[model samples]
Target: MLWFILIPVLVILLILLISCICIVPQATAYVVEWLGVYQATWPAGLKFKVPFLMRVAKKVSLKEQVVDFKPQPVITRDNVTMQIDTVVFFQVTDAKLFTYGVERPMAAIENLTATTLRNIIGDMELDHTLTSRDIINTKITAILDQATDKWGIKVNRVEVKNIIPPAEIQDAMEKQMKAERQRRESILRAEGEKRSAILVAEGEKESAILRADAVREQRIREAQGEAQAIMEVQTALADSIKLLNEAAPTDKVLAIKSLEALAKVADGKATKLIIPSDMQNLAGMVASIKEMVTDDSAKK
Candidate 1:
């Protein structure tokens, strides 16, 4: 009977001892409370809690986290109302502060983000708001990181996810963009046409220049051919006269040649003939020569 009671008591004590031991995983932190008050933050690995005296209050993650808040209505300086949503990247820096700093840290961050967004939008016009996302993100991140420092929250960065303007404003912007695109297209088409016309004119100019050059070359060739023919005729005539002088013909031969030339002139289509001054003497000479030929034939 004594051995049975001792065994049950020993088992119960072993179970309680095992339950007091806690093992924290990687990238995790455990906030321990002593008598319902802030005590110590246990890091990853094996940890021990005082039985019936200390407890794990909260578990905090040390890794980076992202939270996307819904769109909040904000009024610009120009009184234009717009809806804007944001995403925040954050991490827990101090586990103790993260557990006890605020009632709901995420809710506080969301409210802070919305309030900051409104304040920023309230200072800028709608046009400026639409174009300044980087500036807005930087400002909001700085403000949130500073505000949440006491809560052991580090805001790494903030992003402006979406910005929705009114329906009428969006429609007007679309129409304006369409008109601008059309204007650019028209300008491009006109430039292309201008280039094409210039190319055609240049081609025609080149063709005209080529035609004129060809014509000039042809005329030059014709003039040279004519000059060559005239030079050849003159040279041939000079050679013929030199050959005749070398033969050294007598007066009778000369006279007979002159008579032959006169006969040829008489048979031409001329209306008049110019006889040489020695034509009468030539006729007497011709008669005497004919009488001599008659005497010779009688003797033969």
Candidate 2:
């Protein structure tokens, strides 16, 4: 009878021992409360609780989490309306403050992100906002890091997902881009035409200059040839006249030359002939008649 009662007591003690101690997964932490009051946080692996007095209030995940804030309509300094969507990457650094400092860290972060984004975009014009998105992201991160310092939420990174302009504004932007592209194309075509025209003109100018130089060289060569020809003919005529003037009247050299000339004029075939009526005409006729008479005497 005493052994049976002792076994029941031992079983109760074993159940209490196993129930108080809990095994938490790695990268996870649990908030523990003692007698309905906040006590301490339990880390990964094995931890002990005060049996029924202490309870696991909440299980807090310590890993990095991404929170996307709701789209906030922000007006730029230039009064352009746009919808901004943002995503914040964060992690819990201190479990105690993360659980106790803020009731809803995600909501708080979203609200803070919206407000900061609005403030940042509000200070920039529409054109500046599109261009300086990185600057705005940095500013948001700076503000969030400072604001969430006490909450034990580390803002790892802040990114602006999309900045949506209105429908009419988007159409206007597209038209403007298309117009700019067309203007650039027109300018490029005009520049190409201008270059082509310049090259063609340069080629024509070079061709004309080459033709002019060739003509000048040809005319100079022709003039030189004509002058040389005239000089040679005049030299031959002067030599013939000197030979005739130097000949002796009784030398018979002129008579022999005259006979040779007359023989050449009547040699081979001479169906019809004309002689100039000048001072040498009668002498030529006399030489011809003498050559014929001399030939007849030689034959006899």
Which stretch of 10 consecutive residues in model 2 shows the poorest summed lDDT? 248-257
* Residue lDDT tens for model 2, 1-300: 999999999999999999988999999888888897889888999888888799998788889999887678999998889999999999998887888899888889998999999899988998898888799889999999999989988998899988988889889999999999999999999999999999999999999999999999999999999999999999998998787788744434555666567678878487975554574865765676677679889999
Error of 1 at 90 (Å): 1.5
lDDT of all predictions = 0.93, 0.87
Error of 1 at 5 (Å): 3.7
lDDT of 2: 0.87
TM-score of 2: 0.60
Error of 2 at 135 (Å): 0.6
> What lDDT tens digits, residue by residue, belong to model 1 across residues 40-62?
99999999888888999999999
In model 1, which residue pairs have backbone atoms overlapping below 3 Å? none
